[model samples]
Target: MQFIDLKAQYDQIERDVNERIHAVLQHGQYINGPEVRELENRLAEFVGTAHCIGAASGTGALLMAMMALGISAGDEVITSPFSFVATAETIALLGAVPVFVDIEPDTCNIDPGLIEAAITDKTKAIMAVSLFGQCADFDAINAVARRHGLPVIEDAAQSFGATYKGNPSCGLSTIGCTSFFPSKPLGCYGDGGACFTSDEILATRMREIREHGQDRRYHHPRLGINGRLDSIQAAVLLAKLPLFPHEIEKRRTIGRQYTEALAHDRIIPPVVRPHNTSVYAQLTIRVDDRDALQEALKQQDIPTAVYYPVSLHHQPVFLRPDAHLPVSDEVAAHVLSLPMHPYLSDEQIRRVTTAVLEAV
Candidate 1:
């Protein structure tokens, strides 16, 4: 009944992961090692991007991407209010404002239709999050950004293995960032992430930004952070990469089963729009009595989590008394994430779903 069975996944790939970690230990180049570059290259190829820059965490990836794009003070980055704080925190950390936008009621992703209205002269970028492992409508979001002459950054932290219109998640925008936190679809043993892009200049800048802005050893060109991914984490990702495609398939199948079993008048299963594929980073559902349902499931020893209990605009640090994001607020109050992982067994799925149905 694990929320995310990282242990089961590790057990399947333990030998390979151990070997990779051992190689890193023997090399003694913990930071910016050969394994790091190897992982970057492999990730870029998988995502169909020309370059991938490994980062210390998903938050680090977002920071590096924004720094590379020159997102500085007094700027505004339009984003969904329903996502994790990292989405807005990254912008505010740069002395920028995060313009709040509502999300689609069904998908819980940023509503592309609401994006244009939020833009202003200070708007520097449009950052759309792919929530619950399904990509936002990039085609429409990109079109709106193009019209406004604003760069679009896809916050694909939850949707790394997802697809939109036959294109990969991280390669579908000016800059796409994803997390490799242990719970992510393509995660390592610890905190890790990457930024993907075909633009050589942006790629170079991000690489530099992740390593204290040094063009060459000791040649400082710009301000940056110590955001590089470690060699051991890179090694873990390399060992897991070959098996990821199959894992994605298993996730998809499990998601389908959940959708089928959880169908009821009171339960609202997540919707996967046509022409898009979700990695099911979390199989979230909506219910009117979320807290009561969660408690009931807990009584039955079923684990459940709230992806977000409050929208970004409602957070104390980023509170906006005037913001009007009803859908984001509503979704935040009702959403509950069930146990989800590729390694979940049919019996486990049935047990979880049965509890959910009875609780609801």
Candidate 2:
């Protein structure tokens, strides 16, 4: 019945988790410790990237990536308005503009088709968010970016373990960023994130930026922030890393089951494209009476969530009165995320799906 069964996952890895944390505690190097470097190396290897820079949070990773890319004031970053605010917030935080674009209704990811039209002289980068654990169409997106000669940053916060066209999510772009928030597909005990890239210069820049732009201790070379990921969190991740492949498979199975069970005239199940494999960060569905259906499911003790109730263009902080992202607007009002995790039982999936089908 748990939305995300962290307890079950913890139980499975308790010994390793405890051992890793105990080692970290004994080492007493809480910040920028050896564990952090080890985790970075492991993550980079998994993602098929040359470097991985640990960060304080996913927001920090995005900010550092943008900073390392030299995105500055008045520079426009074209991105999906349908994603978590952090996707656009990081851009705005740098005094850069986040140009909102529509998303594909099925994937709820930024529509690459609309991206080229949004690009202008001010467009500095294209930030493609891999929403709901599914990667956006990177091949097409990358093609467009190549034409514009712009960098593409995949916001893989929700799709870290996902694959797009035989490539890992984080390694499919100029700079890829993912979160280690507790509920994410691959997560730590507390806030953490990492940036991935093959570019050595960008990698060095991100590493320096992660430590307040210090090339050497107590010597600052550029403006940056304290975005370092702590050792304890790194330890948690290292312990969990080995179990990720299994967890991802479980999630995919659960997702497939949910999709099969929720097939009805009134419910619109998630669509995983032919070339992509999702980690099912959230097994979301669309329904007309979303609030009513949520209430009905809640009455049956089924926990459901709305990833986003309003599109970014409609948010007060980033209001765009002239914005015309019709698909983003429509999907926002209808999408609902059901209980999703690697530990979801067959019975649990059935219960949730039954409630949903009846409610709809």
Candidate 3:
């Protein structure tokens, strides 16, 4: 079976997607075309945020947010160790230190209780990653950020379609960044991303940051990168946005089925927060013998992946000599991701769950 059945999803929306692409091609405004603004507007409405700025990739979105916040050398950004490298990579790329806190063993998200201890005078922002498409406890994290007078950036790359209480994922913090990589829940055909914010100043800053720090054509105001999303990708996302809500519901339904099917197994299913809905971006689970389980699942023709095999603290490039996160270390060793997508059928889910249960 396919890990993420993008082909099946395309089969349903091919006509609309093709029409949108044709329009973009005819207009020839490949850079900042009308479709790019249209997508930004649609995403802003969906995220319940005042503004959204298109980016080249999720990493670009995070980089722009850091720049907008004025994070500089000797600055520190508190974040979870247990996430995709982009979460911490963006911080380090800005000449700032990524102060990683341990994760909650269940959700694999940054443990908010441990965040305060990691902060210091150098702490510029609290970057909380929404791992496995479920948002971290933003209320608790935001309370801590408020007490410390620090801004919070929600790394909503995986949780774009998710909701925390009644608020959307990208609207839960001072700045929200999400990826539109092909594998993400609200993905486009290629690399694309966005930054969401209610603050007009920050929004304006990000818009400039995405375009080489230009206030207007050739008016360079500050250092920035070529991070704008292309019009073709914007067209693809615009076409997909209409069906995103239904797809999110389908993922939840499949997640429930996977949970029920493996209820009696030794493997541990995902623990979604009471106030949040996951988009099941990875459908990760824990097992005692993850390596063996992965091999066995392969034998059963069920594709499995490892979302994160190493903690940020343990990465050779971004190594920290002093800090040690036990939960991040432990979870990294055991986590495995099953094939997940809205297009997955009941029979496909049963096949996946059955293989995983037997393997574990």
CA-lDDT, candidates in order: 0.94, 0.95, 0.92
Per-residue lDDT for 1-360 in model 3, tens only? 899999999998999999999999999999999999999998999989999999999999999999999998999999988888898889989999999899998999999999999889999999999989899999999999999999999999999999999789999999999999999999998899999999999999999988899999999898899999999999999999888999999999988888778786578899887888999999988888999999998888888899899888889988887877898899999999999999998888888887776666
lDDT of 1 at 250: 96
Task: For each of the candidates, give the backbone clash count.
Answer: 0, 0, 0
Q: Which sections of candidate 3 miss by over 4 Å?
A: none
> Residue 231 in model 2: shift from native, Å?
0.3
RMSD of each candidate relative to the true structure: 0.7, 0.6, 0.9
Segments in model 2 whose C-alpha atoms lie over 4 Å from true places:
none
Over 22-61, each residue of candidate 1 has an lDDT whose tens digit, in order, gives 9989989998899999999998998999999999999999
- Score candidate 1 by TM-score against the native: 0.99
- Taking all chains together, the TM-score of candidate 2 against the true structure is 0.99
> Tens digit of lDDT per residue, candidate 2, span 55-107?
99999999999999999999999999998999989999999999998999889
Write down the TM-score for model 3.
Answer: 0.99
Off by over 4 Å in 1: none
Deviation of model 2 at 167, angstroms: 0.7
